[model samples]
Target: MLVKIEGIVIRARSFGESNQVVQVYSEHLGKLSFVARGAKKTRSRFSALTQPFTIANFLCFSSGNGLPTLNQADLVHSHQAIRQDLLRTSYGAYWLDLVDHLFEEKEPNPGLYRFLKTAFDWLEQEKDPDILTRMVECKMMAAGGYRPILHACAQCGSEERRPVTFSIYQGGFLCETCKHTDSHAIPLSDATIRILPVLVNLPIDRLGEITIKEETKQQLERVIRSFLMEHVDIRLKSWDILEQMRKVWAASDDSTST
Candidate 1:
């Protein structure tokens, strides 16, 4: 039972001293794991193809029951540049971690695979990493059926003429009258409201073209973090590492500002 797959290396772990356990998000197989024999010990052929963020062509053998065993792997593109920069690497790991948490195993979703490929391409080209990361998160959330409501109120289905209250619990915006009654809703800006559709619908490659104010970007980032927490509901270990890095960057930013 030989299968060929095109996928991104979402995760890799050591299997003894000579092999590896890899998890990949494939176009045909959704999220799947493979055991690469001798991929670590002897500088084997599949060495380069097994790293995180490496897009690869894999040949595997399985009984369609459990984790597949890797027979061979051919490197496609490594997105090596993404690993060179600290910020890019952190964001990329965050993106892949989200993907790992959001997706189900062996449920084929070509749309997600393509979306991630585009995202990696953008990151590889040295584009705005944060905006691209947000864009991918937005699109991936939508694909997982947790799409955010921005244009109108999610509660009463009202399309009011002003900024509305976004409720993660209610799953969208609420009108002023409705928001007054609900204690959990948060205020949103019109700019953030208007851009939700574009973020969900546009291609990732063009994400850099979307101009947003710093305040609006903060709002959107908060919204996304809240949304993911509500839906995914798992603490990521990498998130803490990223937060430490963000604080370092924040201090640098503050110094520059002063």
Candidate 2:
């Protein structure tokens, strides 16, 4: 049987000297794996279309009992700007890894596709990496149906000014009373909560217009890391690299301050 789908290449791996195994997170099929023949050799037709982060239209054929093989693929958007930049490359890998782990095979999810496309477009065009990361996290969280509640306390009914803590067990922000009850709860700020919705709703083209303070950006990053650690089941390589990057940055700042 032959299947056609529009998708972004999330992962690519070498199968043999002449063929490669590729996994795409598709708009129509959720996640699907394919074998692309001779993609690594020079002047391959499927080379551009099979690379990670590439968006393309693909024709695949399967025996109805085993893995599919790519018959033809046409590139729609390669997003070279994002693939070339060092900072953007790191973030792009992180984003795709998260997507790959969270989504299931052949499950149709239009919202997830939209989020990935928009996020890549933003990272390709946006000047600031901080805003891009924030926007990605907010939308990805919402699309994944794991967004932390920012409006009300997860434990208790109070909405007033109160110490906020995140309950990985409860899956959102908690009130002072809840924090007092649990020792594992992590602190969060009102500013981080306020900025989240903006990231969720705003378009990628407009992301550069919003200026965020470094402190607020760090806070948001921490909140996102904690949430992913609790919810995402798969271990991510890019996330480990990102954490090391942050640690290095923090150590440098400490030394400079001293």
Candidate 3:
């Protein structure tokens, strides 16, 4: 039975001679891998539709086989700008890598699909791609059950407190009383504790000209990094590359500021 699905190409890699294995995050069918026969050829039927970030409609089927086999594909969203820019591509690839590595196959995530599609569009016009990427991470975390309890202390359920520690081990804020629970809890500024919930709730597209301090961004990064390490349950090589690119971007920014 041929199944028609709309999805974004999260990954496409060489399988055998003149063939490719393509992974797509479909809104209706979740993540699925299809073998694109002869996709490697320049004039192959799937030549353009088999690459990462290409949103397309696919006619595919799994005939009791290891992977679904694609019959035909048509491009839906070109996403040409992301591919043409290096920094935008880096962050965009980071998003794709996170989805490919962290998410489970055949798990329908419509909310995530919408969020991802919108975020990718924003990446093309990303004023600060790193910050945009961080926003994406927060949204994905919320969608993936890793949302941190920033509103109140995760332990005592008390709100509006100072000197709270963000406990990655405990999965949220730790009040001074509950701080003893996790020795590894990192101290968060009152402002950071206040701002995190905002970021978690904020829409990615509306993040224009809303400048957050560098210190606050770093603080958020540390907290999110630990949260992912503790909960997401996977390490990504793309994360390391993103970090290296971030350093280079930062150094360039610093030099231009002087």
Give candidate 3 misplaced runs (Cα > 4 Å): 160-163, 253-258
Candidate 2 contains a number of clashing pairs equal to 0
Cα RMSDs of all predictions? 2.0, 3.3, 2.2
Task: Arrange candidates by TM-score, descending.
Answer: 1, 3, 2
TM-score of model number 1:
0.92
In model 2, the clashing pairs are none
lDDT per residue, candidate 3, 1-258, as tens digits? 788999999888899999999999999888888899999999997888877788999998878868888998888887888888766777888898888776788988888898788888777765767567778888878877788887788888888554479999878989888898888999988778777887788876677847878898889889988898888887888888877877887799999999
Please, what is the whole-model Cα lDDT of each candidate in the order they appear? 0.82, 0.78, 0.84
Where's the lowest-lDDT run of ten residues in candidate 3? 124-133
Off by over 4 Å in 2: 159-163, 200-206, 244-258
How many pairs collide in each candidate, listed in order? 0, 0, 0
| Model 2 lowest lDDT segment of ten | 161-170
What are the models' TM-scores? Answer: 0.92, 0.85, 0.90
TM-score of 3: 0.90
Error of 1 at 218 (Å): 0.7
- Tell me the spans in candidate 1 whose CA falls farther than 4 Å from its real position: 63-66, 253-258
Quick one: best lDDT, which candidate? Answer: 3
* Candidate with the larger lDDT of 1 and 3: 3
